[model samples]
Target: MRKLRIGIVGTGYVTDCHYKAFKQNRNAVISGMCHTYNLSHPKYREKQESLKKKCKGFDIKAYNDFNELVSDPSIDAIIISSTNSLHFEHIVAAINNGKHVLADMPVVTDIKQLAAIEKLSEEKGISIFPAHNFVYNEAMKKVKALIEDGRIGQIIHASFLSSHSISNNHLLGWNPNSELSKGEAMFDSGHHLIYQCLYLLGKPVKISSFKSKTILKSMDCEDTMQLSMQFVNGAMAVLMQSWSKDHSKMINGIRILGTYGSIVLTDALYFNDKKIMKMNDYMESFVRLSKAFSDNILKKVPPLSDLNAVHEILEITSNLYKTAEIESLRII
Candidate 1:
């Protein structure tokens, strides 16, 4: 079988992770990469030079523009790791050019753009795989299995805690910029835990949220978000996302309570408070997610979810964000 050729857009932190993940995949090869460099900014010169070195080391082609990358017949797919705001146009370009896409999360800034993306993919017979990497974690996969096997019986409540520390680089960059990132922590990196909850428990019917900037006050956006959800099954979930804290052990951890038993996870597998299995490094989740995307493209396995599932998550996320507008946010 011919290996899938991938072109990566936006050569940055998330792109670096995707590159490393694809390198470990036997079914795919990263043929090239390109970023729509902000030529107006003198700072991007350093970024372009860095990308040149990366391309040389990997022995892959680098396009000067996204159009060229998507137009290359040698590349079978493109990874859209660009800014949150640029995802829509990038994905559309790839799909129109017959290239499959693995787009990073908060895939698009707006919920209205999702249906058009779905329509384009269907018209082109291509896949627009969302980079919802946390759900691919072995521990998360195990949790889904346990819930289905009745190990914890019927779930009553789920709590997801994301206390990640943002870097000085990202804080000074597009992440905290409202017009660029289109959101704060909850809809950004925090999207990991949000999607994982939805993945394990299914979509929620009701969502209420509060956002505040307790830390990282240099930025205009909120650094902390608290979201409460009510599922149709009558189960409840509470998510607390904080860019203010730097707790590595507590990042993306969850606790689930069911009728018969409960589970608490903080970097290790625990069932009813008994440790069952140790987990792998967090980077492993990205690799596993890449493999899933590649295998699905190869028709060797079914996708974790289809385009509709992606839309559902985006819709719920949009609704959740709308519930807490900038005016309501407390900037303490």
Candidate 2:
């Protein structure tokens, strides 16, 4: 069996998760790394060598130019962990090169870009997967199953709180730079919460949101956001995200209310005040997600969710931003 050769575009913190996930998969290999810019940086060189040493059994090539990596004959697919601003370009290049692509969340900041990628992907017959790791989560899966089994009855209301701690203006390396971050922590981490809502309640028809830079005033975009959405089925959801000085351990959780009862999730899934599933470590979901993506390419089966799933979330979030009267995000 020929293993899927994955060329990662960004050698950043998230790339380590992807590397670990790929290594766990016997059917995949990290064949290459591409630094979209400034490949001569000492950090880039150090990261390249470190990754190669980590994957000692496989031959890993590092490319300074993205085009070279995409055009490489040995590569099978691209896992884009690049900056949020670069997702559109990296995805387009890979699809145009006739390679499968799995990009990190908020695939593109604009809905128009997503439409272009959708059209191009259809024309090229390649899969462009937005790597929303939460849907692949063990606890999330258990919740989904219980809902499907009518254990939760019809979901009436849901709330998701996703938080990240950024003390003394110390957040993501890109958080302080609006050009690279595009929006703020919401634009990045919000994808997971928003997509999870869409996954559970489907698309929303009415949306309203309030956004503020509660903390990290130095950042160009909002550090906190609250979104309210109304689904066609009459279900309502409130999604909140923040990157502020909060306890790291108490940052994220979800609650869903249905006709029968409600379930609360933090480190485990609890149904009607009873624990149901233990949430596995975050890296495991990435492993399952990577394998599913490989199968989507190798077996030519349906992806984690169909292509429209990506577009709908993009459209919803785009609308949310517009409604909030937020400033136009920068695009690099």
C-alpha positional error of residue 255 in candidate 1 after TM-score superposition, expressed in Å: 0.5
- Cα lDDT of model 2 overall? 0.80
lDDT of 1 at 293: 95
Worst 10 residues of 2 by lDDT: 50-59
lDDT for each residue of candidate 1 in 1-332, tens digit (9 for 90 to 100): 88899999987787778888889999998889887675665766777788789888878886766778889999999999888899999889899999998888877776678888888888889888878887777887888889889999888999998887889888878888888888888878777777778778888889888888998887777899888999998999999888987755745688999998988777688999999767767689889989999977887466565565667767766777778774664689
lDDT of 2 by residue, 1-332 (tens): 98988898876667778888898888888888866565666576666666556445345676756888899988989998887888898899899898899888878878789889989999999888878887888788778878888988988999999877764424646656888877776678888888787777778899988898876777888888889988888989999998875664565798999999988888888899999788888888889888888888888767555557778877777677788896546696
lDDT of 2 at 288: 83
**TM-score, each model?**
0.92, 0.89
The residue-level lDDT of candidate 1 at 184 comes to 82
Model 2 residue pairs with clashes: none
Model 1 clashing residue pairs (backbone): none
Candidate 1: lDDT of 295? Answer: 79
TM-score of 1: 0.92
Candidate that would win on lDDT: 1
RMSD of 2: 4.7
Give candidates' CA RMSD values in order. 2.7, 4.7
